[model samples]
Target: MKWLLQLVLTLSVTFCFTTAQNPEAAGRASSWIGGAEHEGALRALKWLEEAQDLGDGGGGWGSDAPRALLALQLSNCSWIPNAGMKAELAATKLELQIALLLWRHHEPPISPGRLAQYTLALGAMCKDPRDFHGHDLISLLLRHEPESDFEFAFVTLAVCNSGSHARKRHIRRLLDVTGDTDKHSADTLAMVVLALRCVAQEHRHRDLLRFVAPPALALAALQQADGSFGNLHTTALAMQALEGAGAIAWDRGAAMNLVLSSQAPDGSFGDTFTTTEVVLALQSRGLAQVSQCKCNKPRLPPSDTELGNFTFS
Candidate 1:
């Protein structure tokens, strides 16, 4: 069974490379975001700001500090008007501190997903992932053996973003997983696309480009008639993945339309999590943007304004 899967993937990759060589067959992918999409993203950003937890020692939205911080960084919320900019930067700093705290003291072993999230968040904040508060987040991520394709993808992104070389075996694992299943959810496939793209960005891994296209093509195939790969959340992530992978085979305009249409009057897609992702996708930002982020350190709030003994299990 394993051998058959490998053979199938080998042939599929070969075919993808062959197709990619044809200019007409591999038509340029359309841009996913436009002026209207940018407007919608701003609205979603407003909604995220409104939904943030501003209680004492609170600067994050929801339980996922790393994700929230990454989302805000990607949105470049600091560019908002004067007071709004200050508040956004403060919130971002607090969120960063919260994420660091969680990383330092989370008991019962942090999962690869959470660690990867932290690593990406740190990168987005322009912090050193290799020496974050005495923790080498990149080393920690590399030490884990991802148990699923999701973990593999997350780990790959984190490792690559931290200016660390992802293990060749990790790339092989991603390719194998992408070939092993057609039943992968849009979220999983999208993540795979981003991860593979990260690997392809390095000159050393240029040879791995052939393996990158199959998963992207598979993700493109999952697009629904309404331009979504699934719901609003999955659609948002899928858009990012396709764009990041440079696989413009999907319907960019329709996908953006669906995303914009799903917005509530409050300028949100639904919840905080969904809103964050939708904002990132609408802005055409992905995990890869973390490495490119040029951030200014926001002035820390008073010592009394700390996270207040918050603990992560």
Candidate 2:
């Protein structure tokens, strides 16, 4: 009897350890996305074990590195008991990623669009934007100016993070894009709405919504038979934007299901960068929800006084 009891105890411990290591896999069938995938994010994160130079003077090709860390952070690997990352290994990996990004500095070809994306990831993890390895990432973004629809959208997110508002020119540009039914894709239109929703005042907010409503509705109509608005990327952005805009109610079940289907068995969405983008999109948040930023808060400094002071002429 004594030997049997000891054997049982050992087996129990082994089972528990295995479960902890890959807990997300067990829950995969039930939801499109959830906290369980934080493990996958962590697992995928291992891909960036070594950060070398990004050949385009871009410092590192693994731009998704910061995002992988944020996925783990937002999922509450710590503070949420029974969560994974309790092992020393998980914490070490996180620290390593932070060090990797911060130490590397912002290299060239890091456009405002790219920098804003980085800022969101860093801010999501509670890291400082102003002090990123001696780079004021926010200030750097200002220098690039907005040309692409994506840049306007990201800058809007950056503004929300810092408690700022949209400028007249940017608002105009975004509005112009939103008006063209045939030009921008669902993702670009979603991005436009995302920016407008974050910064517009009461009346303007309503008008912005009114302007976006037609496009937003049209985008929703584009939902494929599989429930995706377009491809994995467009679908992800559209889901977040439509949900955030209050233009239409979302069937999260359907949306999540679509996203989950695209993920490969290895916890990647086809490749490294897509995996990161999907991970972020799965988190289902707009950058403007600043209060959700538990870490260093990615927005600009808290003074309305500082909102537009750094813009290019």
- What TM-score do all the candidates reach, one by one? 0.74, 0.63
lDDT of 2 by residue, 1-313 (tens): 3533454455455434543553221112112245644454444433322221234322243545545444444444231123332222333333334334444455545457656766665565555665654546666665567777777677766755554445556666767776675677777777776676766532134445566675666667667777787777787677767766664755656766777777666566766556555655655343444336455343433345434443321
**Candidate 2, position 289, lDDT:** 46
User: What's the CA error at residue 83 for candidate 1, in Å?
Assistant: 6.6
* Candidate 2 residue-wise lDDT at 270: 68
- For residues 1-313, write the lDDT of model 1, one tens digit per residue: 3533554455455444433431211111223357888778767766665565454433446465556667766666333222243334443454344344454554677778877877787676676777754557677788888787777887888887777776656766787766864867778888887877776674245656666677788888889899989888888888888775664578988998888889999898877778878877877456766666555433222132222332211
Superposed Cα deviation of residue 113, candidate 1 (Å): 0.6
- Relative to the true structure, candidate 2 reaches a TM of 0.63
Model 2, CA-based lDDT? 0.54
